[model samples]
Target: MGRIIAVANQKGGVGKSTTAINLSACLAEKGKKVLAIDMDPQGNTTSGFGVDKNGIENTLYELLLGEAETKDTIVKDVVENLDLIPSNINLSGAEIELVGIDDKEFILKGITDKLRRKYDYIILDCPPSLNMLTINALTAATSVLVPIQCEYYALEGLSQLIHTIDLVKERLNKRLKMEGVVFTMYDARTNLSLQVVENVKENLNQNIYKTIIPRNVRLAEAPSYGQPINIYDPRSAGAESYRLLAEEVLNREDN
Candidate 1:
């Protein structure tokens, strides 16, 4: 079975979606079959892959509610060797709607389990908040990839996030583990950025990726153009970093 990674962080504006979009694209570029699922209500990952929200007839919301089949929801070849199950604003209400559903947290897992053999990697872009949707993603995922912004309070709420992951692992998905933490928005020019990195390494016991994503205007502009960094500006530093991250992820898995 392929690895199912949930690119997750409860904190906002930490390059979580950017990592999800680009990592999937970069892995696809390496000739690995990848399927990215947009579980975020904001749908930035959906738009990042150039999928129009209004035009998508079948989405994660319908799939979770058992109203649509996975085959019908998947947009194949959204990027070369990459497929996407897009999400939109409507997903915002799915949490309340799922309140009474049986095994609500496992809904996503039920769907993704059937899809494992078809791809080398299945990346899930989770919501910013630790809502039912995020829980669902955690339940479905084999591992979690957190993107921490290289700024003050980089460790804030990090303990809680790890505690939650521990709870989920203990009670829900035993297969779930923290894949690693990747530093984002790193500025080699700033002492604070380097300090934050040192602090996290000292305090956190999780594995850390070597590829740190720098702050780049092109990375920020890619979503506006509806493309991943690798496709939006392949020569950009953001693209190069993500490609290196993909390589490291593959190597980590093999080891």
Candidate 2:
């Protein structure tokens, strides 16, 4: 079975979607079969793969609502060795729609189980909130990878996220683990960025990835071009950092 990883952070604009897209792409580049699932209502991950999010008939929304099967909803060859379970704005309604369903948090778990054996890594891009969707992702995942941006509010809501993870591990998925934390948008020139990294390392009891994602223009531009950093500019610092991050991730299970 594949290692299911949820790339999640409750705080928005913390490079959650960026990590989901680029890290998955980097893993694919490393000769692994990867499946990137977009659980965010923003649908940026879906569109990042150059897929038309609005026109798609089969999406994650349909899967959650029991209107479609996982196999039927998968968009293949979004990038080489990378498949995607795209999302759209329709996913915003899933929270309300799932309220009445028994074992609602396991819906994604049940759906993803069917496809696990076919891939090496299944990366879920969770919404930037501890909502039903995030809970569903947490329930389905083997571990959680948090992407914390280097800024003033970096640690904000982190305790809540950890508490939720602990709660899920105790009651929902006993096997779930904290994969690690990776710093994003780090600027070497800024003292604040350096301070944030130091504080996070000292405070968070989780492994912090060594490869900090530098704030680079190419990284920011790749999404607008509907491509991963490597595909957009393989020579760029963002691409190199993500590639290194992927290497770190590939060895995480060893640690």
Tens digits of per-residue lDDT for model 2 on 70-116? 88899998999999999999999999999999999999999888889
What candidate 1 gets wrong by more than 4 Å, as runs, is: none
Taken over the whole model, the C-alpha lDDT of each candidate is 0.94, 0.95
Q: Give candidate 2 regions above 4 Å deviation.
A: none
TM-score of each: 0.98, 0.99
Report the Cα lDDT for residue 150, model 2.
98
Give me the displacement of residue 163 in model 1, in angstroms: 0.6
C-alpha positional error of residue 227 in candidate 1 after TM-score superposition, expressed in Å? 1.2
